[model samples]
Target: MKIGLYFGTFNPVHVGHVILANHMLHHTALDEIWMVVTPHNPHKKKHTLLDNHHRLEMVYKATEEYDHIHPSDIEFKLTQPNYTINTLVHLSEKFPQHEFAIMMGEDNLRSFHKWKNYEMILQDYDVFVYPRIAENQEEVILKSHPKVHLIQAPIVDISSTLIRKSIQDKKSVQHLLAPKVWSYIDLMNFYQ
Candidate 1:
């Protein structure tokens, strides 16, 4: 089976995420796309992130009805300051039956060279890159790589940061999230 691994904090799973995952599943040869919920991103500030469990639950609520998309907490058991290379290596060893491909935005691909053992990652795994509004040099790099493929997924400008700020400001987010997730966030008073 070929699986696309879409890694993110999922601070609170939003509609844009769901759309992107669905797009990957429908457009690519991938069997499924896992929304790998990272507990903490080494590159990001820890204080700005919500609790891992909360983020995971939101992902669950958002993905419950989907058969192709799954919420993964695989990173929770891994060591802190988790690097993508290490995670990919561990996943490859543990799930040898499935071929894993890295799913990422063009923006991240722009800085991919800075990642730990990025060269090895590019050589070993296929990368499914989605377009971002921002112009980046990574597009040129990815275009030249045999293992990288650009996917035409609908780009939504909505972001987790914007959703969180809207909630903090007591604004409506009905359009930004699934009803189940939005209700859960309202009940828990998250992001306030």
Candidate 2:
């Protein structure tokens, strides 16, 4: 099976994520998209993130009804400071029968060169990049790389930060999250 690895902290899975994944699935040859919930993203502050299980549960609730969308916790067991190259290598070895592609936003592509062993990753795997609303445009060199595919997906402006802030402010986030996801957050009093 061909899988698109959509990795994120997913501190809380939101509708924009599911919609973007679904868009990628329809426009690409991918069979399924696994929303890999990262336990610790090197670029993000660990203190700001929720417990791993809580985040993972949100992903589960958000994607339960979609057959093509799945939640993954593959990074939780890995060593701290999870790197994309390492995760790619591990997934390749464990799922030898399947093919994997890195799914990311154009904003991330701008800094793709700075990632550890990024050159090696490009040489071995394909990268599916979607557009992002960034003040600075994505670097032309990386965007035009043979291994990097630019997908014309919907530009979703919704962000986890926005949702988190709203929740902390005790504002309604019903429109931003899936029903089950919102319910889960509400029941647990998360982000408040």
Candidate 3:
């Protein structure tokens, strides 16, 4: 089985995430997409992040109904300040039968060289990159490495940071997230 590992903090799983996952499944050769819920992304700020378990639960709740989409808590038990190379190595060793690939945005491609063991990642695994609204499409395509492939997905501007800010301001996030996920956030008082 070929799986696309879409790793993220997912402070709150929103509709944009679902859309991208769906788009990838529909367009790519990937059999399934695991939404790898990272406890702590080394590059992101920890202060604004919700609890790891809460973020994982939100991803689980949001993806439960979709057979092709799965929420993974693989990073929770791993070392803190999660590194992509380490996570990929662990997953590959654990699931030797399944071929794993990295799923990310074109914006991330610009900074791919900065990641730990980046050259090893480029050589060992396939990276499927989807377009981001703010990134230059031509620049990303021109800069792509041998392992990288560009995918055209619907560009939804919604982000977890924006969603968190909306919640903090007591603003409506009705259209930002899925109905069930939004309900869960309200019921759990997440971000409040």
lDDT over C-alpha atoms for residue 124 of model 3: 93
For residues 1-192, write the lDDT of model 1, one tens digit per residue: 999999999988899999999999999999999899998888889998889888989999999999988999999999999999988999999999999998998888888878899889989999999988885443455556888898998987888999999988989997899999999998998999
lDDT for position 136 in model 1: 46
Alpha-carbon local distance difference test for all models: 0.90, 0.92, 0.87
Per-prediction TM-score? 0.96, 0.98, 0.94
Per-residue lDDT value at 3 in model 3? 95
Error of 2 at 58 (Å): 0.5
The better candidate by TM-score, 2 or 3, is 2
Model 2 lDDT tens row, 49-86 = 99999999999999999999999999988998989999
**What's model 1's overall lDDT?**
0.90
lDDT tens digits by residue: candidate 3, 1-192? 999999888888899998899898889989999999988777787887888888888898889999999999998989898799999999999999999998998788877878899889988998998888764554553355778888888877888888888998999997988888899899988887
Instruction: Indicate the worst ten consecutive residues by lDDT in candidate 1.
Output: 135-144
Would you list the clashing residue pairs of candidate 3? none
Query: Lowest lDDT 10-mer window, candidate 3?
Result: 135-144
Best by lDDT: 2
Instruction: Extract clashing residue pairs from model 1.
Output: none
Candidate 1 matches the true fold with a TM-score of 0.96
